[model samples]
Target: MSTTSTQPANSRSRVITASLVGTTIEFYDFYAYATAAVLVFPVLFFPSSDPTASLLASFAVFGAAMVARPIGAVIFGHFGDKYGRKATLVASLLTMGIATFLIGCLPTINQIGFWAPALLLVLRLAQGFALGGEWSGAALVATENAPAGKRAWYGTFPQLGAPLGFIIANGLFLLINFAMPADDPSQKSDAFLEWGWRVPFWFSAVMVIVGLWVRLKLVESDAFKKAEAKGTIRKLPVLEAFRTYWWQMILGTFLMLATYVLFYLMTNFTLTFGTKPQTLPEGGDPATFVPGQGFAYTDFVIMQIIGVVFFGIFTMVAGPLADRFGRRKTLIWVTSAIVLFGLTFSFFLMPRENPVGEGTYWMTLAFLIIGFTLMGLTFGPMGALLPELFPTNVRYTGSAIAYNVSSILGAALAPIIALALLSTGGGNPWLVGIYLSAMAVLTLIAALLMRETKDSDYTGDAGEASASHPAP
Candidate 1:
């Protein structure tokens, strides 16, 4: 893409494609590691004395990625704001692809002794670091290309990448499982850890090329151009975020807390807890899942596939909803729906025997729909909302800091905390529900306090708008 702000139809289309493709690739790499952490890394990399402890350790490594995210956000946000969105995006993609590919090449615990898990952690951190920079850059690309009246709609184009990435990731894993022999569980798992796991990570290399091709074809945003023209750009974008946009950043982080926690709970936590027989009650094993016979990895995988499909559907729906209903209202309502989702499905989805066999399957489907639908509503509008919260001079850095730092507070500890709650609360998954609800409640409050910014003109004076709106 050219580095000019010419509003050609071709330019807009190219920018949207660039944002969608890049974000999709970034999320794919990030979620691939998350899936591995839950399903394979515990056994392959971190071998603990207890199975649960091993899984916990794996989740900790997963969280390691989230922990590194803020640091990456700061570094990339600075360069993205100072240099440009395109440069930071390409660099982040390269970093993520290299880290993921190296992970595919790492030796298992049997081969490398203590270095196996250490290597896994190192690669995982790199993945987090890259992802931290990925979202905001992608968001900037789409919104910048968008017309004045349709920024949220265009912003949502990149948000679709989240669901699209999940679909591709889980669909690929499901395909691999189906291809493997059913009778040889050990052989299948061994192959998966030894080689099968590498396929998805290695595939990310192709995306880097695809993303670059699309991104390199797009023009920079009009807002950035205007900022550059006025010589109003910050020397230290990240530091400016801390000094001026600190309150907005804090509120944005908490505002996102519910969505992030619900995400891990629905995707990673459910997969882990659902597969373990012990997580289900003694006599209430649902027909769909037999705790002792076998936990339903395939079933849950299928559910996630279904979930991603709806997630895309709902994402499309949310754009117009925000346009019609206002972003804050949409976000508040969506978050409240998530709270109810947790309440309803927390216990209902647990494998339980009823007059009907496999009734929990329905519960699983219900939760999947509910979780994904709510995610679509809030996440779809968030790209526009966060950037609109700040001026163009500080937009890249300020929005990125809010987005990734929130990942640290919200998602980084979710799996660990949910598991701990499940383990300590006599295995009552309801406790996990409460935790999710609390985050949603916090987000609701933050949403209430936040000013609506849908009408803000990004191409005009962002500082003037900021003065009028004021940061919450």
Candidate 2:
């Protein structure tokens, strides 16, 4: 097998399309559940006399999927490393699509009692399991097939799925909300709780079909083919990955920690905090009142959508910048900014004394834009950086483990921890900001400890010798 087959079996268009479409669908499925978790699940799946308890229960189920992600990573990573990227990518997409569609068809708590939440948990785990494998495979497909010196730029295609999926999922929900007949435009309609929330999940089936079509047409990248020809493919990549590259795995996990924490806080925690009423409800006890900006749900989501636009734009921009300046330098600067951004959470998110005033709304919007801009800068480089941390033989397993473990540490607990901190701080977001800043500081340390991977060899069997070496 000539390792010099410069012409790949997959066209550039196909490579980009397959990776972008598959992840877009997968993220769409995940974000659909995320939106519903805040809006509908607490009411429909986990009914409680205490609204706070119900919301917490809903978030707990949301986090349960993170526990399953590492398991998915191990299973899918094994097959991805041993077999090839194409089959594993397709399988992950199918599993996620099926799980998402089934969640749409599930009975609510009103109809099926505890079983509703139980079934929802089962499907949510399946989604997490599929996603564990989804991101790494998509990243590999883009980076492994990239032209020389452009891997980081190619890598951003998969990362682009995050903002695109968020936009589509939230846009669909916003449209559904607007179309529904709500007695109060600020509150959720009965129709939205009963059935409208399920539309995004079912719509995922159509997207899966499209993703499968593109991915099925994909051929193995030359990097993987060369690795196989050299007989470097391990029978058990996960064991080998842990045995040899354990430090890389640890570094990669913490490298991603701030990104995950910032992202979930931007999306999920913001939704909860933004929409909570500033004043107590009529006849409500003063003791239980939680202060918030009191923006209507529709209005707050629109603000989020605006911020996510910068996320998408900056994600594309980070790729070229990373390629030019090196991943380590780019991440160091961005992570430092994230640390600073975390300190200002109270300054931006604090509601004015008049919560409904225009000044409060604009301040919240500014906070979102800045946070999401940082999100894009940090997230874009990770596609190339994580996979670059391992040899081609175990790239899938190594990168997937790092990414998913961070999901547990960062994403799974971010919303729950933020909410707890919010309550602990008497509804002020200073504590939540401190939490984000603390996570960014950890990521910054990890970045400083890691070597630059901009020029790492992708086709070579030897991993980066200096990967564990501290940056000067």
For each candidate, give its TM-score against the true structure: 0.91, 0.96
The local distance difference test score of each candidate is 0.78, 0.91
Residues 1-472 of candidate 1: C-alpha lDDT, one tens digit per residue: 3544546333766877888898899888888888888778888888865667688888988988888998888899988887778888989989998998888889899997999899889999999999889899988888777776777888898899999888887777767776654564422465565688778888888888888888777555677777777666677777667777898898888878887988888788878766666334444424323232134567677877788788888887887787777788889889888778768654565535541246766766777777877888778888788888888878888888888888988888898888777765555577788888888999999999998878876766545333333333
Displacement of the residue 20 alpha carbon in candidate 2, Å: 0.6
After the best TM-score superposition of candidate 1, give how far the Cα of residue 387 lies from its true spot, in angstroms.
0.9
Candidate 1, residue 416: Cα displacement in angstroms equals 0.7
> Considering every candidate listed, which one attains the maximal lDDT?
2
Off by over 4 Å in 2: 1-3, 282-288, 462-472
lDDT of 2 at 369: 96
Model 2 agreement with the true structure over 275-303: per-residue lDDT tens digits: 98887777656665667778888899999
